[model samples]
Target: MCGTHGDHGRTVPPAGEGLRIVVVGKGGVGKSTLSALLARQLSRRGLGVVAVDADEQRNLAATLGVDLATVESIVPVSEDADYVEEKTGARPGGGASGMLRLNPDTSDLVDRLSVPAPDGVRLVVMGGVLRSGGGCLCPETALIAAAVAGMRLHDDDVVVMDTHAGVEHFGRALARGFDTAIVVVEPTFNAVQVGVESARMAAELGIDTLHLAINRSRSAADVERVLAYVDRLGGFQFCSTTVLPFDEVVLTCEPEVGTLMDGSPLADATVGLADGVLAGNRRPAGSVT
Candidate 1:
């Protein structure tokens, strides 16, 4: 579907238009905030958004304006023993040595599992992986991974996945088939380091289109510091870089992104970021020097 900005503002492609994005970054760098902003902004533009919380923290739903009661009541796919067993032929917590279907049929899980959230977005929570006796949570991982893979079947839905803080999710191949990856970072060394690593992994996963968001940036110097760090870390190319200013309200607003006004600096910047993603600009990943 063609998107156009008419009198009613920007109109986006309907559900099933198939734009998949994964937002990754270090912990406490506003990854969930960016994900929530993008999901709400895109949904406002007239598309069906499936916001997936692949993080153990499951902060996306709350940030996206889902009520606290609902957020607490919802169970992540990894923690749903019955659903996991039905889909993958193995139950989690059943000892890490059992056989599980590595490639389960999860093409319909997205539709069957997602719950409704505000702004016309559907929320899918994939709980954290559990550690047991040095064994892998292959069943839980496979279930979540396959469910993400299943999103490909929906020709009209746009997916915005909020991954856990760090690069471990990329190791699970959960980022496969995503068209873009947004690596959010603060102006700190540790955050930039994780952002660079994530960008590298996304590129290696064949997600060529990448964007960088410097959250809670205090000034141009903060932006420059992040860019400098990226250059120092061997230069990962991001087609666009957005700086989300440090907002006192955002810091105190808890997790609900809906509290930000339309003209808020942070919210406005996220709108631009969302527009950039929909524009689908392509440039080879190179040094951001």
Candidate 2:
């Protein structure tokens, strides 16, 4: 059954209030992988989790071993083109307007497109929005935004969104739906730049809760450097400074869509990070000690 919405339009589960955690960062920084790991860890703890893949690339579901066939079968929220036109007031072939017009029955489409993971984890893959002549909001984008809002209202145990690397997803109405935002960055100049831009966008969007996750590190020193950069950027704090070791196992296991919780080194780090983030502890590395 479809969940109900709150006064604020966020989805909230009937049993317990869920956390909306979003993973954002530059490309090739393992943001998607970290998102999958976080979902696996939370599910292992017996919490109901829904992982939303807002990226057009559509890799989050695949990483968790969810088949495309199953994903394409979930029912979406809505399918009324006229309703979309009324809500967004987008033109038929305008840029954002045209995009918003595509797939008017978004809720129904997403419900049909969602795939289920092994341990009761749900995967919603939102394809990219194509810009036409007008600046119409993409229907997929609108659907995700509405879904996030609906999830917040229902209080679904945990809503984890794996966003695209470029911060493009953060610009539209969807950015308003997230409660907490986590930026993933590697130890590189370009990655840092992306992180900075992401942070700026998060702040601009009035996101009250924000955190940084440092992925793919070789040593403790690398972790520290990433932390230092985050500090220098100012405004953002480190929720969990987890160092994901460069593991060839991740690549080898990709074909199987194995999760980090499969007893791998990366999985351990991811789990630890998820625990700290969920607990609302934003201390620097070793401060808990």
Using all chains and alpha carbons, the TM-scores for the candidates as numbered come to: 0.87, 0.76
Candidate 2 structure, TM-score to reference: 0.76
The top-ranked prediction according to TM-score is: 1
Q: How many times do residue backbones clash in model 2?
A: 50
Q: Give the alpha carbon lDDT tens digit for every residue of 209-267 in model 2.
A: 55666677777777767666766666254444556677778887773336446778788
The lDDT, on a scale of 0 to 1, for candidate 2 is: 0.62
Q: lDDT tens digits, residues 167-208, model 1?
A: 877764586667678889999989999999988877777766
Off by over 4 Å in 2: 1-17, 68-113, 130-135, 138-140, 152-156, 232-235, 255-259, 285-289
Worst 10 residues of 2 by lDDT: 1-10
* lDDT scores of the candidates, listed in order: 0.77, 0.62
